[model samples]
Target: MTANATLSPADAVQGQLEAYNAQDLDAFCAFYADDAELGAYGGETHTRGLAAIRERHAKLFADFPQNHARLLHRAVVGAHVVDHEHVTRAPGGEVFEVCAIYSFAGGKIARVDFVK
Candidate 1:
């Protein structure tokens, strides 16, 4: 893992956020499980596995170019970690706030629910 940080889910989430803000794709994916799932808060869309997750992120990183998420708040309860973030898009796009709920399994992120 690129984070080289703690193994706990909380720490992993923190490191993942750091990696995301840094736009380090490898580092960002390192904190996630191979079978990780990413979905929206309303279940409008979802990426069902690691490969899909990577593909989706690759496109996003390439598309946004300057995209980044800044953590405004964090809350942890058991294996669940929630982050409130301010996201800035690239190419002079707008900034929006979102809440991300993360679930961990086997020391890696197993699922993510993005509440926009």
Candidate 2:
């Protein structure tokens, strides 16, 4: 079994959240599958594949150097993990709440749907 196979669904989600808060693109992407998809809760896909996801977040991290997401709550259901996050673009800057539903496959995140 690979190292990733040992991580629980919630653990994978939490690791990605930590990496995202740190603005570490590679580390953040590490938690996702090669063909991972990112999109709105019930809308169109915003990003497809790991590279696309990385590119999207790279711009975000560059634009908001102090970006951070605080975890308000989290729930794990089978192969899915749902997280409630409060995100800040910068200190005293734009803030928003988001609900992210993460789908896991083979111990890696396969898709993420966001609800704002």
Candidate 3:
């Protein structure tokens, strides 16, 4: 276990799910730090502000209107949580799984990195 194993931060995974299910990019991105880093789909690492994250999500939603994320597993270790999720396109299409690690500083996520 990492350093966060003892703190056991609150379950923020549900909020993440709700944010994505609702397509609320702002809300979804709210789970990060002011200068958070996101590396989704094993692509180039993005070190940007929250607005950039919002814009990215907006574009994604526009491209895949029926996309949704389902949290499959979650491990809380102090201020860090590793969430494994399955993302589906449309009602029942292809499912892609990714594991995201969230490290929090204070209450906001300082780093978010994931891979398929």
Model 2 lDDT per residue over 24-46, tens place: 88889899899999999989998
> Which residue runs of candidate 3 sit more than 4 Å off their true CA positions?
1-10, 40-44
- Residue 116, candidate 3: Cα error in Å is 0.6
Global lDDT of each model?
A: 0.85, 0.91, 0.71
Residue 93, candidate 2: C-alpha displacement in angstroms: 1.2
Q: What is the lDDT of residue 82 in candidate 2?
A: 97
**Backbone clash count, each prediction separately:** 0, 0, 3
What's each prediction's TM-score?
A: 0.89, 0.95, 0.78
Question: What TM-score would you give candidate 3 relative to the actual structure?
Answer: 0.78
Better of 1 and 2 by lDDT: 2
Q: At residue 16, what lDDT does model 1 achieve?
A: 87
